[model samples]
Target chain A: SQQGEEDPQALSIQEGENATMNCSYKTSINNLQWYRQNSGRGLVHLILIRSNEREKHSGRLRVTLDTSKKSSSLLITASRAADTASYFCATVDRAGYSTLTFGKGTMLLVSP
Target chain B: EPEVTQTPSHQVTQMGQEVILRCVPISNHLYFYWYRQILGQKVEFLVSFYNNEISEKSEIFDDQFSVERPDGSNFTLKIRSTKLEDSAMYFCASSEALRETQYFGPGTRLLVL
Candidate 1:
């Protein structure tokens, strides 16, 4: 069974627009991490938010976590054509197992 | 910055044939993992290795699947008998700490016929 479930399986927006993707998980987690993958490439870590932390930002990326709702959101500000790719959310269970369970992912298309 | 590397960016093999996918994780990383993504599907965790032992694995990782750190830098995943359904892009990832960010390799796209 999958631990994380991403909403808006597919999204499309023009360049410079803001893109938001949400993920919901089932169990308690130690941390949640967002990753980006270009076609035929490996996943690159974007930002990670620990259970104790509410929000984090890196460059054009903003991540927010709400433990009470067991959900997280990734926002890309002023998106560009280069940002087109599949975005995934992985959750590390609170048990500290160290294994990450990934969601189905949301495919974002940024038009130039 | 150091990144994980995988060999044979693409491989084509016959069903029932054994295949070994290789990966070279970051030199200083302490944990290694293997995950597979079927075409048009989510990334699925296969197994995680740490301290020279299997720390955790998913149901997809059965008796036919095995992992080894043959040397200080190389980590490998071997499948005894490949099935057509096993066709997918296999990714290798490593982390310096237990729950830290994991750096991923380019991935080996395996096609089993």
Candidate 2:
């Protein structure tokens, strides 16, 4: 079963604009990570925020996790045309096994 | 930087035919995993491998599915029989440890006719 469900199934923005994507999950999670996937390509790990950590940043990427809400959000600052891709949020549950459950993903189109 | 790699960017097989997907994870990584994404669907976990054994697998991984680390550098996922419903993009990933950030391969697009 899919754990995370990203909001704004699709987002269109212009280059240099900011793009934000939200993900909501149902169960308790050990951690949450965000990834980018170009069309027909593999996923690229962006950033990960542990349950204990409220927020994390890497380069132009920012990720925040709220355990109380069982949700996380990814923010791309100063987005570029190259940043146009599908963004997905993956969660690892605090359960018997360590497995990642990914969301349907948000398709962001950054027009140049 | 080292990245995971997979062979046969694309594979086409007929229903009931067997197929094997190969992967070479980044050296020094202790954990490996397999995932599949059907077109227009979320990426789904198949199984996780560690210490030469399967640590976990999803219900999608049935008796017809198996995983093997044939050599120090090679990991393979075999399907006993392909089905039309099996068509999807299969990806291989590796991480330093369980629940850690994972690096994914380019993925092999499988088409079952």
Candidate 3:
């Protein structure tokens, strides 16, 4: 079963604009994390929101998790051209397993 | 900040051959993991190791796959016999503890012929 599935597979925005990506999961999760990947590069950890947490912030990244809805959203504010990359949402299930089930990801293109 | 490092940034192997992918996780981390991403696909978790043994593994990690923390610093994933379907980007990651933010290493792109 696919756990995290992100919407708007591709997103394009101008520099300084905001980009919002949403992810929905099938089962209960211990935490939901966001990661960024440049083409052919490894995933860079962005932010993590635990099931008990509603929102989290780091630099320009804001992540919100709604366990009741089994959904999450990542908002990158004041987006920069350098932010052009694929953003993925991963979930750690409540089963105590450490594996991360990732989404297909949203490819964000920030234009200058 | 210390980060996970993978050796042999890229490798090409023939079918039925064996290949070993190596990684050096963050020094202070106690948990290590292996994940892979096929071209244009989602990153999938292969296995997770802690305390020198595999704590969890996905269905994708079958008999063809194995993992080892050969030493205090190095963790490795060995594919006994390579398959064309095995070609993908393999990433190593580590975290201080379970459920913590994991730091990922630059992936090793494996191409199986």
Give me the displacement of residue B93 in model 3, in angstroms: 0.8
Which portions of model 3 show Cα errors greater than 4 Å?
none
- Residues B50-105 of candidate 2: C-alpha lDDT, one tens digit per residue: 99999999999999899999989999999999999999999999999888989999
CA RMSD of each candidate after superposition: 0.9, 0.9, 0.8
- Candidate 2: regions farther than 4 A off: none
Separately for all candidates shown, the number of backbone clashes (residues 3 or more apart, or on different chains) is 0, 0, 0
Worst 10 residues of 3 chain A by lDDT: A92-101
lDDT (Cα) of model 2: 0.94
* Per-residue lDDT of model 3, residues B30-110, tens digit only: 999999999999898999999988999999999999999888899999999999999999999999999989999999999
lDDT of 1 by residue, A11-50 (tens): 9999999999999998999999999999868999998899
Error of 3 at A22 (Å): 0.5
